[model samples]
Target chain A: GQQVMQIPQYQHVQEGEDFTTYCNSSTTLSNIQWYKQRPGGHPVFLIQLVKSGEVKKQKRLTFQFGEAKKNSSLHITATQTTDVGTYFCAGFDAGNNRKLIWGLGTSLAVNP
Target chain B: SQTIHQWPATLVQPVGSPLSLECTVEGTSNPNLYWYRQAAGRGLQLLFYSVGIGQISSEVPQNLSASRPQDRQFILSSKKLLLSDSGFYLCAWSTESYNEQFFGPGTRLTVL
Candidate 1:
């Protein structure tokens, strides 16, 4: 069975601070996706990284995929109160293209 | 434009009661549908996925089952509920051409 693990199960930071969450997979992944779920709300798609060693940015957020495709990270710069949410990383198992493994989310709490 | 809908937004049931949750996708045809569960303070867990009507794949063996009666309709059902069934259930959809998944507002279930 494929598994994805995320670090810092919970994080609390000041509004202007930086935050990062790391994700690792037991097996190689064909692609990885990032999602954010606001408190009491549904998860929303953020970005996807496909190529190894790939880095993509969306405004204050930066996402990176490991060269081996077995790990990834999401970094938020100068976090804002509105950025508080649980961040999750999902990976498509290389062995089973149809199966997507989800990491336990990193819950972010930004305080003003 | 695409949207996913799930209902009822929240539910409460006694132990041993039957359960049913519905999810539907709009503005897309023949999309891949998925069901996931998230316990309090945890990450999303893959439950079931359907590639088309009458096609389903179960990711974990639980007291639950899923069905796809229409191209864009997915249902999660259980003969009898347990306390462990209490959690937030989410529905998501993705097109064949893309790997990013769009999620629906989740349903919060509480099995008393």
Candidate 2:
């Protein structure tokens, strides 16, 4: 079975600080997707990376996919109170297209 | 424009009670549907997915079962609920297996 491991199960950072969460897969991935779930809300799709060693950015948030396609990271700069939420990364195995292997996710808490 | 709908934003059920949650997608044809559960302060756990009507794949074996009677309709049911069944259940739809998913608002289940 394919598995995705995420680091820093929980993080608490003050406003204006930076935060990063990493995701690693046990096998090669066809693609990786990132999502954010605000408090009391459902998960919302943020971004997806397909090319190896690709990087994408959305305002203060940066996402990078490893050259091996087995690891990914999300970094947020100058966190705000609105940035408080749980971030999840899901990966699709190159050999398995039926389902996406999901990480346990990283919970981010920002203090104002 | 696409939308996903989930009924009963919140539910409270006693142990041993039967459970049913429904999800539907609008403005999309033959979309891939998925059911996921997330315990408090935990990560997402995939329960089931459907590629089309009557086509379902279970990710984890539990007391839960899923059905897709219609192309865009997915249902999660349990014969008898347990205390561990309590969680945030989310329904998502994707255009393809490797595409980003659109999630419903989700249903909060509290088993007593």
Candidate 3:
């Protein structure tokens, strides 16, 4: 069974601070995706990285896939009150079913 | 524009009770559908996925079953609910050859 692991299970920061969360997998992945879930809200697709060593940005958020496609990271610049939520990374093993394995989300709390 | 819709934003049931949840996608044809469950303060877990009508693959062997009767309609059912079934259920869809998925608002199920 393939599993995705995320670090810093929880994080709290001031509204103007920056935050970063790491995601790693037990096996190689075909691609990786990032999602954000606000409190009491469903997961929202943020971005997807398919190429090794790829990086993407959405306004204040940046996502990167490792050169080996076995790890990833999400960094938020200048977090705001609205950025308070959980961030998740999902990926699929190369030889397994297409069902995505999700990482335990990093819960982000921003203090104004 | 494709949109995913899930019914009954919240539900509460007792153990051994039957349960059904519906998810339908509009503006997309023959999309891949997925069912996911997320426990409070945890990550999402893959439960089932359907690539087409009457075609389903279960990721987790549990008390739940999924069916896709139409191209855009997916249903999750359980003959006997358990307390552990309490969680936030989500439905997502993606187009062929593309991995980015769009998620619905999700259903909050509480099995007492």
Candidate 4:
């Protein structure tokens, strides 16, 4: 079975600090997707990386896929109170019944 | 435009009671639908997914079962719920298996 491991299960940072979460897969992945869930809300899709060694950014958030396609990371700069949420990374393995392997996720807490 | 709908934003059930949750997608045809569960302060756990009507693939083996009677309708049911069944259930739809998913607001179930 394919598995995705995420690091820093929980993180607490000041309002102006930066935060990063990493995701690693046991096997090669066809693509990786990132999502965010607020305190009491459902997960929302943020972005997807399909190419190897790819990087994408949304304002203060940056996402990168490893060259081997086995790992990925999401970094947020100058966190805000609104950035408090759980961030999840899901990896799509074409060889694994076409299902996405989800990570345990990293919960981010920002202090104002 | 596309939208996903889930009924009963919140629910409370006793142990051994039967459970059913409904999810539907609008403005999409033959989209890939998925059911996920998240315990408090935990990550997303995929329960089931459907590629089309009557086609379902379950990820986790538990007291839960899923059915797709229509192309855009997905249902999660349990004959008898347990205390462990208490969690937030989310429904999501994607244009393809590897594409980004759009999630519904989700249903919170508390099993007593």
Using all chains and alpha carbons, the TM-scores for the candidates as numbered come to: 0.96, 0.98, 0.96, 0.97
Show the colliding residue pairs in model 4: none
User: For model 2, how does the per-residue alpha-carbon lDDT over A1-112 read when each residue is reduced to its tens digit?
Assistant: 7899999999999999999999999999999999999999999999999999999999999999999999999999999999999999999999987788889989999989
What is the C-alpha lDDT profile of model 3 across A4-105, one tens digit per residue? Answer: 999999999999999999999999999888989999998888888889999999899989999999999999999999999999998878877467888999
Residue lDDT tens for model 1, B28-111:
999999999989877888899999999999988999999999999999999999999999999999996248899899999999
Give candidate 2 misplaced runs (Cα > 4 Å): none
Candidate rank order under TM-score:
2, 4, 1, 3
lDDT of 4 by residue, B1-112 (tens): 9999998899999999999999999998999999999999998898999998999998878999999999989999999999999999999999988899999999999999
By summed lDDT, the worst window of 10 consecutive residues in model 2 chain B runs over: B52-61
iRMS (Å) per candidate: 2.0, 0.7, 2.0, 1.2
DockQ of each: 0.66, 0.87, 0.65, 0.79
- Candidate 2 local lDDT, B1-112, one digit each (tens): 9999998899999999999999999998999999999999889998999899999999888999999998889999999999999999999999999999999999999999
- Ranked by DockQ, the better of candidates 2 and 4 is 2
- Residues A9-50 of candidate 4 have per-residue lDDT tens digits of 999999999999999999999999999999999899999999
lDDT of 1 by residue, A1-112 (tens): 6889999899999999999999999999999999999999888989999999999999999999999999999999999999999999999988788877888899999999
Runs of candidate 1 exceeding 4 Å displacement: none
